[model samples]
Target: MNLNPDQITNYANTFIKVLIDYSPKLISAFIILFAGLYIIRLINRFIRSIMVKRNLDPTLTRFLADILLWVLRVVLFVSFISKLGIETSSFVAILGAMGLAVGLSLQGSLSNFAGGMLIILFKPFQVGNTIEAQGVTGTVCEIQIFVTKLITANNQTIFIPNGSLSNGNIINYSLQNFRRADLTIAISYETDIKKVKEIITAVLANNPKVLKIPAAEVSVKNLTDSAIQLAVRPWATNEDFWGVYADTLENCKQAFDAQGIVIQPYVRESSKSSS
Candidate 1:
């Protein structure tokens, strides 16, 4: 392997020519990489500022900003490599295929994550708020990326998938300042309806938790063979909802007893026939 002097000279010239031809592209790619990264950073910071001004949840803001940053970085990376004469179509195709495969395998997890994002963004319910959703009624304890934690009235902790929670009807009890408690009381048909309404209205007015602005309503909801159903509606602050509900019921019962207004039992068709 002895090379002639002319052959060696020719090889050196070829190497220098190749480097000269590619140097501009290499420099341009480096510049683009740095400039694109700086632009991405600025965009992320601007997004974070907007989110903060909007009072978005801190966790959600950070998560979304990071996602945006990475996505922009990926696009910039493709651009940078393409500048240096590297083909990016195949690279992008490979990435897309991998993303699809991972997405299919984690369908449920992805769905839950998306649901969590929606819940956080929309704020249908917040931590410490009592809500009824998907047949579960409890105070929201935590909002995670995949599930929401709730503490039931019985003090049991339950984790509900965000996917179902976001899709289902949500009754946020704490959203409004006041909540109306609907108490249905059945009394013997023999009792005077006017007297019953007066007694229940007095009971609601006596309760300190009940709101007076809306005025407590006491109306006959239905009349059965043995009883009259009275709909006793009372409004109270969210903090006093359960207390007002329980106390109102107890006070109404005591009031009825004092006035000798007996609560009638439900007489079913089968029981009536047997009797």
Candidate 2:
């Protein structure tokens, strides 16, 4: 079938009207969307520089900066879409719903993350410091956003979750410039307590690492069922704690042996006080 001239003319007019109505708006929306992406990227660079200047943790800096960039880009895209006369309320509502769902699913993790932030802010321990936390005692090897690393006294590396650390007690042993190297040497009941105390004090004085300022006290702390407990407490610099402890024990044994003071058995945990 052949169309009439008026029919052809009417079809051409309709096509031209549609192009004029939609083409400019579509082009403008596309430009706005692309410009928004570029702007967001520039903003991200600015945020990253600020984070660096502020000396933020590298991992935390990246995490927070990335989230910021994504928020801006999403907002820009939503605005651009709306400019093209598309409805965004439903889209935003869907996003909010999805976000809520995600949040619910990650509640435990989120709580843990918040706890981790608290830990970092409070700074109970730093890397290489000896600490006891969450029932695990060790030296700190690393600290991160979600976990803390510990090197055990027995040479074991432990990774404890940040949530557990923040919830439990933290014992930082490295904070003090000096530490007391506590030692207890028990002598048999027959041994003269006064003689043992005098001899122990003399031995401690010879050790250079043991501080003289504390005056190296020797006291008969208890008369146990097995023996008389003569406690030797010597102060030393924190760095020399283990060395002084070892040397004191070894030298004290030799000194006591020369005087014929018999050593008692090592005591394990017992609530039964010295009888």
Per-candidate alpha-carbon RMSD to the true structure = 4.7, 4.8
Candidate 1 per-residue C-alpha lDDT over 26-139 given as tens digits, one digit per residue, 9 for 90 to 100? 999999999999999999999999999999887688889988999999999999999999999999999999999999999999999999999998999888899999888999
Tens-digit lDDT track of model 2 for 14-67: 999998998888899999998888888888999999989999866567768877
Show model 2 residue runs off by greater than 4 Å. 1-70, 73-86, 266-275
Which residue segments of model 1 deviate by more than 4 Å?
1-50, 72-87, 267-275
Candidate 2 has a TM-score of 0.76
Model 2 C-alpha lDDT versus the unseen true structure: 0.85
Clashing pairs for predicted structure model 1, backbone only = none
